[model samples]
Target chain A: MNSSNSGNVGIVIVSHSPKIAEGAADMVRQMVGSAVPLAWTGGDIDGGLGTNVAGILEAIETAWSPAGVAVLVDLGGAETNSEMAVEMLPEDRRARVVVCNAPVVEGAVIAATESSGGSPLAAVKRSAEEFYA
Target chain B: MHDAHASRSGETPVPLTASAVLVNKVGLHARPSVKLTQCAKGFSARIELALAADGPWTDAKSPVKVMRVKAPQGATLHFRVTGPDSKAALAAVLALVHDGFGEA
Candidate 1:
């Protein structure tokens, strides 16, 4: 079940500014007390989404120990980028990967920091709960 | 443009490097790039973006002009100014870049 991933959760942050991603992740680290894998992809792609997309995919493949992984990004074409990544993954693996609703920086941190005993999906939902609320 | 800021500060106006993060994913594709160019034109600042290597310093205000450059994701653009507001101009451009050509 998708909930199976609640046991382990990982994050990749995409932002307009590299510093913001790094900075936001740092804040989450302090609050949660653990280091989630962090990747940098400025919103403005001078070339294309290939670099950032590749980095996130690679991070997920390596970072997650048991369950699935989550991705959070600033706005604009972030959805497109995330969607593209999701589409490329195998169908079964796709269920494990989810693009989160939390603000890229804040959401990633919260997800990473608050990861406790729930599935990765559950944790991701909680991280973005505030936004929906 | 050389003495753009010289009159204010006797020190020769050194071209400053300003950068912004592309918060969004789509980037300054076309519509947004147009908006960014328009804002850039308002200032007497000379701005150029370094995405790969080839660059054409087009009129910032003209949408048609900027849409030509295909700026994608994960691209770090270098914006330099040598005009009157070169210093502040760089900051503004950088902000817009971070703003994702206005789309973000």
Candidate 2:
């Protein structure tokens, strides 16, 4: 049942600091390996510490997988922007994406590992969010 | 170590089990938890990992439960495997744990 090539959900890491986003994604990549698709966006277009809707949208699109995509944000604004990004997508695409409330680093690693096992979007989100408890 | 077996008049035998210490400095955190869960998923048996030598078995296939145990360095974990490939599953888990999960 392990098809490393396809059917695995994708992951998006969003944070106010580009360094945190990139570092979290890198950690996830190390844990989950190349089997799962991962993307990240942090800081505004000007490279300041803030969330950007366009950047978040681009990250979701870049990491899009047929299975689905789980977006993990660092804080409140990032979560709001990530939700906006998901809303910007077509109805069909939006249905496959979920904004998860989880710690950026630990959640990404947990979500990526679950996604690599070909878990559905909801399951991946649930697994990642559990890290907060 | 706990015994994960039952004696029946006729059957393929009881479950296969293994126990190991959390030798890695980080214990069952992100990295090692991911590795152990992945290895558990590779097998067909129903595997569970317990934080101590006694109770509270968590599904080995789930990274969430594995990390929930909050096992620190020097903690002992018991792996209980059931199903057709119990022996193989136990062996795989022990091998990874014994290898220190590639930690220094």
Candidate 3:
């Protein structure tokens, strides 16, 4: 972890296709350069095109940071599963995670950049959501 | 270029301006746009970029907006920067473009 990423918000990318999720993560890495903690989850238990709440939970944990975690998802199923995953977190951890209603790849990139700047969770979420504005 | 009279008169200083051509092979693609936005966000000044000098400018600090500009190779990027740190902001953006965003 780069020292600049310390105490910055984390980010998670979720999609129905594992490749899409990983590719978005790669974009974030290229753009922000590990300036923020990042993780991704996709595919179903049988490795099919679907989303799994368990995977999302694990990703959130992997990208977890003291500052908070922001999640960007593709498609409706991914979003619902992410919400479920957020619900599954411990009561204390629930509030720190958010599922942004923004384009997955773009949102993740923008959110990661905002987080790298040491913006708080709410501000990161707002910045990512600005894509729709 | 501090003008004591302008400050005393409570009139805002004119925005600083500069232009740099995109020499990188891929122009202002994802990586370069990201670098530009990240660089722009570091300054407090309001920075905007456009392909032409006159209009249709976009915020330099917004990655999505900056990337959407889709400036191709050889496109010139015009910058208008305002606020107290306008000079530094304009210089930084010009330097980034002149450096080819470190891609060249």
lDDT of 1 at A68: 65
TM-score of each: 0.45, 0.86, 0.87
Q: Compared with the true structure, what per-residue lDDT tens digits does model 1 show for residues A1-133?
A: 0111334566666665666756766655544334344444543446433235664565456545445677777776665677677778778888877777767755665455434323356655564544444
Give Cα distance to truth, residue A2, candidate 1, Å.
Answer: 25
Better of 2 and 3 by lDDT: 3
Estimate the TM-score for candidate 1. 0.45
How well is each residue in B18-94 modelled by candidate 2, as lDDT tens digits?
79988889988878989998888887788899976566889998898898888898888898888777777899998
DockQ of 2: 0.58
Docking class for model 3 is medium
How would you encode candidate 3's per-residue C-alpha lDDT over A27-125 as one tens digit per residue?
Answer: 899878887889999999999999999999889988999998999999999999999999999999999999998999999999998888778999899
User: How would you encode candidate 2's per-residue C-alpha lDDT over A8-99 as one tens digit per residue?
Assistant: 89889999999999988888878878788888999998989999999998888778899988999989899999999999999999999998
User: Which regions in candidate 2 have their CA more than 4 angstroms from the true location?
Assistant: A1-6, B1-14
Summarize candidate 3's per-residue lDDT along B1-104 as a digit string, tens digits: 36676673422377778899999999998889889988888888889999999959999988778888999999999999888777778888999999999987
TM-score comparison, 1 vs 2, better candidate: 2
Positional deviation of residue A40's Cα in model 1 after best superposition, in angstroms: 4.4
- Candidate 1 lDDT, B1-104, residue by residue in tens: 65654566632266656655555577656445634654565566676665533444544543334545566667666665676677776777777777665454
Pairs that clash in candidate 2: none
